[model samples]
Target: MTARWWQKGVIYQIYPRSFQDMDGDGIGDLKGIARRLDYLAELGIDAIWISPIYPSPMADFGYDVADYRGIDPRFGTLADFDALLAAAHARGMKLLLDFVPNHSSDQHPWFIESRASRTNPKRDWYIWRDAAPGGGPPNNWISDFGGSAWQWDEATGQYYYHAFLKEQPDLNWRNPDLRAAMMDVLRFWLDRGVDGFRIDVLWHMVKAADFPDNPPNPDYRPSMGEMHSLLQLHSTDQPEIHDIAAEMRRLADCYGDRVLIGEIYLPLDRLMHYYGREQAGVHLPFNFQLIEAPWNARGLAQMIAAYEAALPPGGWPNWVLGNHDRPRIAARLGEAQARVATMLLLTLRGTPTLYYGDELGIGHVEIAADRVQDPRELREPGLGLGRDPVRTPMPWDESPNAGFTTGTPWLPLNPDWPMRNVARQAGEPGSPLMLHRRLLALRRTHAALSIGDIRLIDTEGDMLAYERHADGERLLVALNLGHDPQRFVPPRWARGACLLLSTIDDPVAGDGEALMFRPDEGMILAPQDNS
Candidate 1:
């Protein structure tokens, strides 16, 4: 199998609205990102994946796209996006746009026309059906936000399906015309030099034709949200979805070297199938295990092994630690563990994605009652589902608004931004930012860290250890996931390997022979030619 750029390179995700703000409308824009391309390039990332910047109503922020081919005014114009794309390419980095094909905003022209009348030409563009005989939702499908997924339309006397917020209605991908239009949307960006796309809700593109009610989830818990009350057996991961992905994959192949990545949240067995019947679907299905996995040695080791064992032949793997929707790593696993997580993420066998500001060890910021902005929290307050805390603006310097904007930011800055800002952390030799820079730099120079063969090493205590070797270069990554001091003994063959890097600034971190792991420490040992 050929090694693609996406397979070896690191991807950095930038939530456009939180990265930087040039116009100072208290929102981030395309030109703002273009201006900071140098900073990202310096961070040693090979690509940048900007979240949706398409025309939207700000209902789901930029996810509820009103126009697929145009940029939102708040995020600047098409010309600005082109400039940003050029800027990224000039710096030898790839740029990936977010594609939300599963749904469109209620305000979108297609949805507008579809809702105008039942007999309209565009009526079939979205999912619509007659109400149930009892005059409620057609079935028991629940919205991802809350309540019923079906919304009654007074004029049409029918109900429309929305997997998420009512304002973001789900599209009917089974429609031939609708699929064609979406394919055109893909071409429009490909023609403009987009490297690829990180498609949202890829598995939700198709639904069971019969529209059978999903069975109740036997393990549903209140904390898991009301949407989990019923298993999504009928609504998601339908078999036909893979066929649509194959079509998209074929189209992408026309633009050589272009890759397609899907945003799928499923179990290891189900998630691996997104690679398609013969690995012809999306280039990468986005392994989010790292984002949701528990921070424990045995569990994490098992997850890595299970995922590795489940990959389809010729299918590459990718890992994600944090994103716009999930809580920051430092907040969930503590600052010390976040460092270890970073090492784990970059040293893994395949591509890794880094969320912006994570390099500076930015954790979740508290959202006050008055400062709450996430729609999920607003609809179902106190569910702890609000993502605003993790989506705060990036802290650049110690100046006002953390140098994010001249005007008041859309979200509050972290109170400790003065100490955690990029400018401050960048200069700290032992800061998390430096750790990221060092790790990324190491990945570039060491093939073992990127595309090599991996062997899981069993350990005695709360330690996760693995060896990655290819050619004559070999490396061992050992991590202490617990608070107690744990020791790791490398295989007898690694007699000459010494410590290459440590998570903390320690002058005496151990070698491969008899490694002593301090609480919350992770280290890499190198070059055992004996293997």
Candidate 2:
């Protein structure tokens, strides 16, 4: 297999608005990230995936892009972004930008022009449809933020479609002109030295052309989220999206070694399609089973097996345990169980994505409704509590505002920062952050973990065991997920293995048969040399 930098390297995700606030404007900006490039380098990440920072109305935070080519005034200027790119490269880390092409803020020039008159030159740039016979939205589609997905325009006497918020209208991918315009936007950034892109809501790019009414999901409950009430069967994950992805992949390849990671939230079977039949689509289709599935060895193993089986031959795998959109992994898995999840994520046969603040074992920071700034929260009065908890500013120091900013941060810092801050954790030898650094170093040094074939090893309950082999070498990993000690049945291949890394201190030698594990412990063993 040919070596690809992305396949063997770790990527860190930075939600720019929450990473660091240099101006003390209560929000993080490009300069803050540039200042911290060394810190990320020290963490041993090869790339950093930054969320959207384009000009926006801030309707969905930065996801609602008003101008794809311009930097938001709130995020500084294009020069600041260029400086950030230089700093990241200097530290040996590539920058992967977020591409929010599925939709644009209603304030965008294209949307404005399209909505100006019914027969504007750019009328087809965005999805526009006539109202129902009763003068309501043409379909029963719902916005992800809340309410109807369509808003009637007084000037056109028609409703423009928005999959997210009224301020963010869905782009018309079916329009070749719009697609070409988006491609030009891609070239503009690729020319500016962005290493790659994390395409947002990739599956939502192409909607069913016929606009067929989505069937109602039998399992759907309004409590699941207003958006989930309507089945998205035909409206999302359209087959035609593969053609667009192929085009994107070709564009990225033109830049040589740049990658396109897709944010696809479909089942494993469908998610694999993002890789395309000819391996001409997304280089990495974000694997979300770990985030959505129940926390159990059996369930996780099943998901791993399913994903492995579905991957296109020669297509690489990627894993995401947590992100700004989901609760922290540590909080979802019990405080003690978080380490087990981390072990699995790092040791799995894929490019693992580390979410900022996750290495510090930070849990979701509870933000009161009055303090919540997410548009989803504002639009819905307590529908699923919104994503503000996961989007809180990074806790750096125990000082006021967790040292994230000199002034108050845009969002409140987690109240538990005194104990959870990086300052406190960095001081501890066995801190979660420290553990991450060590694990990353191990992956960097050991080809077995960094680039190896994964094989499951059968063992007993509350524990998951696997082996990674590359060349002629084998590395064994055993994770005990419970608080109690468990016995280890020596597999034929690992009977005489020597312990290399362990969460808990051990005497190096195990007398076969059984091994005692203390709480959330994990062990990596290398074959013993009997020379």
Candidate 3:
């Protein structure tokens, strides 16, 4: 039996605005992406998941979608997207678009009509309720981006709920009409031959039927985002979400070979249900443990073990090191360990999602205050919550704009672009790009590294070890994830094995007696004569 396309595929994420700029308008457009299809193809990713490109108000950087079925003019028209999709398909790569169903931009026609009057025919399309007895917000829910979740709409004489920015009004999935409309939006794109969708904020689409204030979180800390201030009991992740996910699954199945990727951040127990009540949920409930777990060996080991055990039967796992919203692995773990992260992600049991620019080791950049475009930062100043540092443009070469654009980029490039650009790293030995390419190539020829079963190998402090086996082929992945050097005594199962790939290209990777590992070194090894 053949595995599904998503089962063994590696997904690459592109923040389109920062990917490339062809029109020289200081923004990345669909045409610019099409121009770089060859580059991504060379990266060896099986699928490309581009962030939101739909017509949006830019309140949350494309999350506040103004029109569900139209492309944002800034990112070019539907024709450009069609061409890009075709280009990607021609290269044997799949394309996944970011789909936002939880909310719509305040400017959306539905929202406009819904807020025009309390008696508007579309008033039920959004979550609106009468203000409290004191004319305050209807509930105590808070926005994920910050502040109260309810926005007072004087024109409609009510408070409408917004889980993010006020410009992003939450849609009422309880309303059959709105659900049908969103489904049609998905159909419109599916009809255009796009491969799939990464459903944004998938768990937040449905809210408690009864309006109630969320209880204050006992564990809330000032360091955490403001949304954590409440327990979110009545705000999100409601039971009805299962049915909605099933609906989405049914729709995607209508187009054979299509996938549904959900963006969910809940704990493993809660997150697993997205796979479906009867194994009919999303094709992949994105596992973000890598992003949220501690960088230490113990933290990651425990998390990985728990996640592996929690997965539903026959559910495929995925690993994500970084994304547009999170800090880059290099930025968090330094360039050295970022290599280990790459090896770990690629050699893991399931799909691996790579963030653009990570393969070149370009991470967080210092953005000047004036050039900051993230509204979450502007709204909650001094919270150290801005995501602009990680969403900078991809550095292609040492051109004036780092070869991303002829004009000034929307945000500053990584400070080290002059040396860390992809053009230079593509040729340099032991470069981050080369390491990624080698691992990707290995994955192509080694089924044991992809679609394999994983077993935890015992190791001491600051060390993580695991085995991936399939069809009698076995490979061991060992890593020292700390600043202190460590030693690895190969298990009996790993006897007579040699290093397949190392973080620093160390020639002798567990080939002989107990080896002394350099700080932050990661290695993949195959048993002698195993293949």
Q: CA lDDT, every prediction?
A: 0.90, 0.86, 0.89
* lDDT, model 2, position 52: 94
As a whole number from 0 to 100, the lDDT of residue 450 in candidate 2 is: 86
Cα deviation at 77, candidate 3, in Å, is: 1.2
CA lDDT of 474 in candidate 1?
A: 78
Which 10 consecutive residues of model 2 have the lowest summed lDDT? 504-513
Across 1-531, the per-residue lDDT of candidate 2 in tens digits comes to: 566889999999999999899898889999989878888888899999999999988988889998999899888999999999998888888999999999999999999899999789899999999988767888888887768888988888889888888888999999999999999999999999999999999999998887877777788876788788777886799989999999999999999999999998887788889998854999999998888887666767777788888888888989889988888898787656787788788989999999998998887677876788887777776666478888889988888888789988888877788898788988887788877888899899888898899998876787788889887888989988777777777577677777877765446434465666677788888878511
Per-candidate total of colliding backbone pairs: 0, 0, 1
lDDT of 3 by residue, 1-531 (tens): 267888888899999999999989889989988998898888888999999999987988899899988999999999899999989999999999999999999999999999989889899999999889987998889998879999998876889999999999999999999999999999999999989999999999999998888999999997788989999878878989999999999999999999999999887899999998763899899999898787888788888899899888878898899988888999888898899889989988888999999999886687778887899888877777899998899899987889999998899889888999989998887999999989998898888888888998878988899998888898999988988888888787677777788888756634366767888898888878775
Error of 3 at 495 (Å): 2.0
Q: Candidate 1: what lDDT?
A: 0.90
The CA-based lDDT of model 3 is what? 0.89
lDDT of 3 at 391: 89
Which run of 10 residues does model 3 get worst, by summed lDDT? 506-515
lDDT of 1 by residue, 1-531 (tens): 356899889999999999999998999999989988999988999999999999999899988999999999999999999999998999999999999999999999999999999999899999998888867789999988989999999998899999999999999998999999999999999999999999998988898887889999999999888988999999999998998999899999999998899999999899989998853999999899998888899999999999999999888989999999989999888899999999999999888999998898888799998999998999888888899988999999998999999998999988899899989988899999999999999998888888888999988789999998777777888899998888778776665576789998885445546877789999888744535
Candidate 1 TM-score to native: 0.98
Off by over 4 Å in 2: 505-511
For model 3, what is the alpha-carbon lDDT of residue 381?
Answer: 70
